[model samples]
Target: MLEVRCLLRSVRFCSSAPFPRHKPSAKLSVRDALGAQNTSGERIKVQGWIRSVRSQKEVLFLHVNDGSSLESLQIVADSSLDSRELTFGSSVEIQGQLVKSPSKRQNVELKAEKIKIIGNCDAKAFPIKYKERHPLEYLRQYPHFRCRTNVLGSILRIRSEATAAIHSFFKDSGFVHIHTPIITSNDSEGAGELFQLEPSGKLKVPEENFFNVPAFLTVSGQLHLEVMSGAFTQVFTFGPTFRAENSQSRRHLAEFYMVEAEISFVNSLQDLMQVIEELFKATAMMVLSNCPEDVELCHKFIAPGQKVISFVDKAQYICCLIISYTEAVEILKQASQNFTFTPEWGVNLQTEHEKYLVKHCGNIPVFIINYPLAIKPFYMRDNEDGPQHTVAAVDLLVPGVGELFGGGLREERYHFLEERLARSGLTEVYQWYLDLRRFGSVPHGGFGMGFERYLQCILGVDNIKDVIPFPRFPHSCLL
Candidate 1:
């Protein structure tokens, strides 16, 4: 009788269990709604900050943006639903129905049925004033709030697209993606511009140091990519590189991203040059095709009143011209204009010299190859020219931005590399680097392109700081 009573109680408890509730679907992004067709009469939810608001006696019109696209969605709300807090920079959520718009700027509009304020923002205290065009330099002072501006929003979108295009270019070419270390013992450039790592709040002895001897933030990932090239025929790395230089120029940054690639079994410098040309052209074409509106916005910001051209259009007229370093020197000598730094055989090319060379070639991209050996690093291959003394190094100089890309064939001969390293006082530290050539080294080459510099070139942005999200320089590291 007791067992029968317990069974009845269990059956009653099972019958009283609650059923599972289904979750609501996710909200549609502004970009999705802009591209969608036949969304009329459909109820949708959108959450974003107010870019602009107009309150009228009969109705209220709000321009809302969610950073998904360059254009904003027009929302029409009843006058009764409008509140004083629905000003610029205020965050809110709206439930509305999509309908055909009578305005010419957009094809569709949202008729708000419910409006809820998530966060209220005071218009008088906001740093970004409405309807005011702020200079890029002024915007630099407010990095935290500058992204809400239209100019920065467009630049960031283009930057993101360019990054994706780079990855696609490498993946389609059968290249493997590699991640090199940020903390390394050797400076790849051998320029002695490394940021050394030390313990916090105390001076530790050499034996008690973090890396025991000395570790530094890597100036370049070229050396690590070279190590990976031994196993993978083609490999690349894209990440932040650091430098301790004290330059406060628009071109210099304390930390920046570098896109480096290494290829094995290359025959000559021309093969590597071909890779560089195709990579630039392919990436440019992708960005121009994918983000036309964003690119246009950037051009408008940089060069107002100038007609903006499609990347494909500009690329069609531009051809990659290759000139020997000797020929380039001769050309500079014959130029009618005076240069700040005279174009000598052994001296590295300055920014003015590079821009002049591009202009001399009818404002096109030019690859200046076979630079003097003394001006380059120890890893560059030595050209067999007797008196000229040049190495198989190259720099791709575009019209606006000088020296956009630099690369060369690496020294693969074991004895030659060892001798070069010994002269540079890095033989002991890079004995492992020498081992690659000692065991089995094939002909290889690669190049490094500054990521921010590339965006500045493509988008016509004058300053490198404007292209990057966060600008880092000497005495100026702000949020």
Candidate 2:
């Protein structure tokens, strides 16, 4: 039971009443009041964009979707009526009684007696259609309009539900919602490449004294959030986090949303991974239960659409489960035929290895913990006994996507923190972060899970661009 209050921030909604309305009986989404006992005599109004309009010999069926469910309402309108006037992308409201029909196995459907077109999309101009098969790459190009399609619409909705579930899980578990600044002066992650904004309308060169000092877009919010954790006890921030990495891989994005949470008085890396695991379990259950329609939509469109023709009806395409990096490598050694990249200890798992591990070895999400320090960021706590260069970090990977999450227990000692920063050549800039340790910082750990990546995983969408209504990638920037 998901209750969503439509606070349309980025979406543009039609105002000033697109059409005359009859008495508004509490409007219900297709999934919500669909199969209720009161559905027999219930007079309800439902509004959504038309998914498809089909006319039979004497009856017309307009499959309408509100981004609520993959199963569209089979609106049985009279053939004498004008359904040709309706079009895709048209916002409509239908008032009717809910009834079970034998034509389909659907539990419930709207027996529409009155249909009103609030807004109509021109069929010729609308890029999406019921019959045509569009490429995923082509759909990525049109991020904003992609959601109008049933598959993309369900993806966006599932993404929304997952996002809400994250906040709910944390909020319920005593995590304070902290709003970390987007424009910051520090690159705490020590990732060299970043986007820097200047006052003079040019890329600020550090040597030229632009803006007097170089200030780049923030790569991570962990360091600043650490400062807040001392007072808040448990704090988390969810917002757009930027990284200027120029990698054009399908996994990396220039700008994305991160859910960064830091807790005070934590002891070890084990504590951090436990929290991450719980978060993953809660989120997965929420999606599986609440977003059943969206999940089915993913099965129909993204998985079985064309590329996944063989495993359309199969019980499993890619297996999902939790495993360590060492375990992942061991599993990879046995399943050589399925993967192109061979996984090895101390080496970062490629997207292909992640896909194979989940597809064949593990039938669920995999958590690869205790990564090599040389590969991990400078702030991760080091493991001196096992390997000097290895650190205590964990990355959550799924079948369709790689590196959905990256988090670890932060190095708490002042000297070790200073040593790592100095070795990485970031000492001068990160002195303030070390000051947190000097004053009253306790052993703390946190992780950053990109909101878009979670969205892609939940919806089973291949590309991150489709999940976000307005995506800011390396190439495209449009509202």
Candidate 3:
């Protein structure tokens, strides 16, 4: 039987037909074609998904978008070149003459010689229709098809450009980028809102846990970035973070991206806040300047008359825009607007308080520092001020978005960390963290900025879900 099988395989290999061969043609993206005025009258192949198809008796016009930009290229084809498959949302390829458009709406257009439909869309079954201004909530249901919309396409481009700008900022500032672990043994925030990680098919009992320890999706990468900051002096990480938060609010998400940076030899909260301000300002400016068209599309539709954040040199250079958390509480207490959660020194600040505080600061980014130590994590450095104990922490509150960033100087003293951990019974679990303090520990601090909030602040987007490509919330993890 083995010999017969071998003979059959050999015969099949010899009798198999060769695959078809085709020459690859040079392609032109809509963005490049629009920019290239010198390429007029040249023959080129353009490929993209059909945005709008208008049929006439003599001329067939189609607006195609390749997601390279917000603008779509106009393809002017003969009426005879039209096909049933060339409908909205369908993909197509065309060999055409690039010429000046007769209509002033566009500078140049594609005068097509050959038209081919690469993929067809079922218009009736499609969840989205062309040229319809669909609400963001309605678009949320169809995650797979949402990017095909103009709003989402522009958002994704802005997101991509912002990501690149972040990397570029860190690179130019001599900061090392670290890819922190997605799965960690310790809950960095200690919030108890962790997504416990386990293998897919098997439910291991307490006696036999995977890797012989409890692990979870990390809520923050600050601790891991701290480990690297020890040697590098400056390190940054930008990636997805998970929190098992059950709230269905517009701002909350189960999975979101965080931009975290740890700087070594930082003694005070002021030093850490400077880096945070610069990082946000530089990246936001880059996104605005590079993707102007995309930004305009989002701002015009989602947030009308919204202006991008403009930070001045002297404003950021000076730290006068900061207020102590105690002062913030006092201001909130004096506010006429009744806050759901009353302003108190020991309690955490809510969104209403944050909004009031930002408004009090002339709608500028306000840095609220020295939060109550009892509410903060064990990692924050203690103020040691009697009666009203506070931590060397800071939270950046913006006008549109409440709390955009939060961070503080770490507890670098050995005795302080030991006692804090002992009080919480985390001494055994975070021994590796303590070990870093034992030898050559320097004063270090870091901060984490919510990437989605940054986008929201810059683009004037209302919901956090609209910024991210695949939003993961309480009960929704659509593909």
Candidate 4:
């Protein structure tokens, strides 16, 4: 039997028999056609599910989607194949000659020499059909098959690209990437929401689990990354994080991914803000260059009328205008969107505000920093001129997602850390975190960006639930 195994990023070669490699038939894609002039007259083998099938009396046109790029491969399958089985979502492989000019909207079309059905999907029950629009809720329920859709496939692809770019940007900057533990006894920064675990088969009591101590899914990797930064000078951790909040908004998910980076011996908040701006700009440029197909999909579905070419051009222009936080706010206020409220300094930004800024202003990308500490996390370093207890924290809000990142310089001084803890009324549960300060500490800073939220920003996806493969939102946790 021919076998196939799928990995998260790369599909693996799965077969019992030795496979023939005659130039390893080039895997032509729907996206390949966009650059088809390069693949002219090449014999290619394309593998994907049929996204949409149009069968007339003379020719059968199958829109094959491999989730490689946002577009679909136009395959001209002859009437020799049974029309009944050649319906939507059927996995198929087409061996054909690539044609550069297809006389259609698509730039490339496959003149199929042969067609073979790898896995047949029933058209009647195919969740994605040719007729009506499906609700987002219904699609979420069928996540296993959601990627077959053009929009979801585009989102996943863009997410993968953005993640790669993140590593590339930081690694190129000489920052070491670290992996933080998922289950640990210590609550790093003493944040309230944690999902505790029980290790010994079952729990007679919460304390009787592993190590006779309670462990929970980590909420943020900032604490451990901070420790690593003390030793390595610069480090980052990109991984999954969980929050047990029960809020059912589209933005909140119980389990999500986070990208965290920490640096040591930073001069002041200005240095932090500078790093933040550079990182966001690099990310935007990276996405624009690497995932133009996915970016087009984002504009098509998430924000209609948003052209990828225009967005990149505008972003570059607006990024120039955003020298200060006040300037960013003013640009956001003047944006052409139906904003429910106005954008101003000291006011916590909403999703609408961020969308306006990214879609309007200079349009490349901007980093709004120096938020009022009252609205930020407790671990941020207190600002010199701010009111009592406010810290030098920053949240990086992007175009589509309001607060894509949350982080700040940690309270390095033991006395100040303890005082802040007591003042916030969270002293009792964080004695161990306090002990880290007592033993040996350094002036360290970092921030956490929700991995899925970052994906949403890049792909122009609206719902947090869509980016994650299996979502764990309030009132729903199903595979």
What lDDT score belongs to each candidate, Candidate 1 first?
0.87, 0.74, 0.88, 0.72
Measured against the true structure, the TM-scores of the candidates, in listed sequence, are 0.93, 0.79, 0.92, 0.79
Ranking by TM-score: 1, 3, 2, 4
Point to the candidate with the largest TM-score. Answer: 1
- Candidate 2 on 270-337: residue-level lDDT in tens? 67767776887677677777877667767677766433222212323333345666777888887747
Q: Model 4 lDDT vs. the true structure? A: 0.72
- Clash pairs, candidate 2, are 318-359, 319-358, 319-359, 319-363, 320-363, 320-364, 320-365, 321-364, 321-365, 373-390
| Per-residue C-alpha lDDT of model 4 across residues 1-479, encoded as one tens digit per residue | 13322352234335445777654567756566546675566888888888788888888888887777666778886776687877787888889888765476977788888888999988898777765556566788787777766667767777777788889989998899999999876666555688888655445555356666777889878777766765798899889888888788878899888888898887576676666666666777887888776777667667665444465435544443333455667777666666787776677677777766655654445556555666666577766564533466666656556667666777778887788789887787677667767766777787777888766666566688988878997778877
* Model 3, position 164: C-alpha lDDT score: 99
* Global fold similarity of model 1 (TM-score): 0.93
Listed per candidate, the RMSD to the true structure in angstroms reads: 4.6, 8.2, 6.7, 7.6
Tell me the tens digit of each residue's lDDT in model 1 across 195-222: 9998776676655877777889999999
Model 2 residue 448 lDDT score: 89
* Reference-based lDDT, residue 104, model 3: 89
TM-score of 3: 0.92
Best lDDT among the predictions, by candidate number = 3
TM-score of 4: 0.79
**Pairs in clash, predicted candidate 1:** none
User: What's model 2's overall lDDT?
Assistant: 0.74
Model 1 deviation from the true structure expressed as Cα RMSD, one decimal place: 4.6
lDDT string for model 3 (1-479, tens) is: 99999999998998796754633435889998888766558777899999988999998999999999899999998888646778899999988788888888998899888888898899778999976899999999999999999999999999999999999999999999999999988888889999988776657565676878888999999999988977999999999999998899888899999999999999989888888888877887778779988877877899876544343222344343889999988898888998889888899999888988887888778999999989999999999999999999999998688999999999999999999999999999999999999988999999999999988888888899999999999889887
For candidate 2, what is the TM-score? 0.79
